[model samples]
Target: MMIANLTGMRSFLILGFPGLSPKHYGPVSALLFFIYLAIAIENIFILTFVIFEKSLQKPTYLVFCHLALNDLTFGTLTLPRIISKYWFGDSIISFYGCFTQMFFVHYLGSVTSFMLLVMTLDRFIAICIPLRYPVLMTNNIISVLCGFAWFIPLPLVVAIVLHALTLPFCKSNIIAQCYCDHISITSQACGENVKIVQVTTLCMAMVCLLLPLAFIVFSYISILVVILKMSNAAGRKRTLSTCTPQIFITCLFYLPRCFVYVSNTVGFSFSLDVRIFLILWYSLLPAAVNPIIYCFKTQAIKEMLKKRLRKTKIGIKIQLSY
Candidate 1:
């Protein structure tokens, strides 16, 4: 009732890293701004390369395109507002604004997790069942899978935000974390039933994180068995080479997340600062690093970059000759 009365007027104050000193806010905000810039530029580079390079159009790179786009959207949804909180002291976010941010944060996370699963499945099909790779995985099928990955999480996340909105927020309007999130927002709800929302959010997060992980585990195991049986050492090496980047990316995305959730479940505690650091570490670090992984680990992208450089150099040389 109270929350409804203040519907359009309701807003929340975001307190980013509550333990940090006022003096450090400038440095920290600058650092975050640069990181956000890097994430944007890197992911945009990948998307542009995938768009223009016909040679790179395949199931694997298609998934990379989706991952890059997801990272861009996720970073945009999360970083700038928090950056403002520290840099300009613009900490207030309105009711609908906070809910909108929370919805996309969870929604894009689910999309990334599913995108990783799709990457693993691409590898599984390529290595585990080589003959059917062409038939089982095609551009059209990849397109459909990408579509489902983005679409499937919409209803679940909407339900979460809607439920959170209905809860009476007679408690404090100050959010302790950097950005609006399901747990952070719901913690400020004033009612005994808030526990129900917490439990359900936890379950949803576990399913989103763990279910893709289970399939990833199964896919890798099958991939490994096939790789071990290959008579040709060169082929085995090549196969492992192809799988390694995705493996690095998978570990990057999932391991920190698992550690945090597991620590919470087992009664282990971190300082609020440390907990916030870990959340940002897992959420943002992967986006910053993923493009680097694709650029360095994938041979095709490397070759394309090399060709572009060579062309640039030749053009400069021709001008010098003139």
Candidate 2:
């Protein structure tokens, strides 16, 4: 937020508000802490609802449960730092601290992206290949795929950690973004021999992000055509609405990623204002938005939450009456 302020309004707008500001960090920290607490409380409610409610037990909702967990992983990674810095203003991070944050951000981010691809593919199979979906997206398949998503990025993060940590930081160690982002580090390291940053960025994008995005696009395009031809507007709306939250999430992530990649590889002197703004929007706001998107966009989940909360309140009242 301070970075956005320093950069100017153009920078702040480009970054999209994560609902924080330079002057507001002290108070803003309290708000974020409450937000994080709410996320935790909401998640606890979700898990409890899923566990006790047999009707809600299914592969699709299970996938959603996993997504909520992933949100926590990504959310906690960035939010605490914001809260701490705002309350304490202790903005300095050690080598391990910054890398730890980056590793989780990248790892969980990749997992979430891949899981979203798996989700659309799951829907495609279920809708397009209905009989097989039950057999195909079985507990074992979900387990294996989710496990694979969890582990696939470990090796990639390990390599990045090594390369990034190995770089000597005789220059200024202060990271410019809200968190320790790769571009910020690379920019500081850049000189005549910026080849390493370019190569690493390319390799990371290709092997980590691009492949999954390609698959997602291909999968969705085919599914959309099939839905469009269904001749039932209601059916088509249902299918698309089911995927709306996921689509919104994907576009938010991929769009800035496109911007970041262009800025990094093309060696464009991307205005510092522009760059910082992009980083915040790309990294922070997504976590805050994910839960709200799910609750609002998906009626089933919304109802589930409401029913559980109502029941819990009644139970408490009953106990108190005793």
Number of the top TM-score candidate: 1
Would you estimate the TM-scores of all the predictions?
0.96, 0.80
Q: What is the lDDT of residue 289 in candidate 1?
A: 99
lDDT for residue 224 in candidate 2, whole number 0-100: 82
lDDT of 1 by residue, 93-182 (tens): 888899999999899999888889999999999998889999999999999998988887788788878777777776678777888888
TM-score of 1: 0.96
**lDDT digits (tens) for residues 1-322 of candidate 2:** 2222211111110121334467876676777788778667665555566668787667666766777788777777777776677787666666567777777877788787777777677777876777898889886687678778778878887787677655544444556666765655554453444568547855884777878888888878877887888888999898788778777877877888787878787887666556666775676565666667767787787887788789999999999999
Clashes of each: 0, 0
- Kindly report which residue stretches of model 1 are placed more than 4 angstroms away from their true locations once superposed: 1-9
lDDT against the true structure, per candidate, is 0.90, 0.69
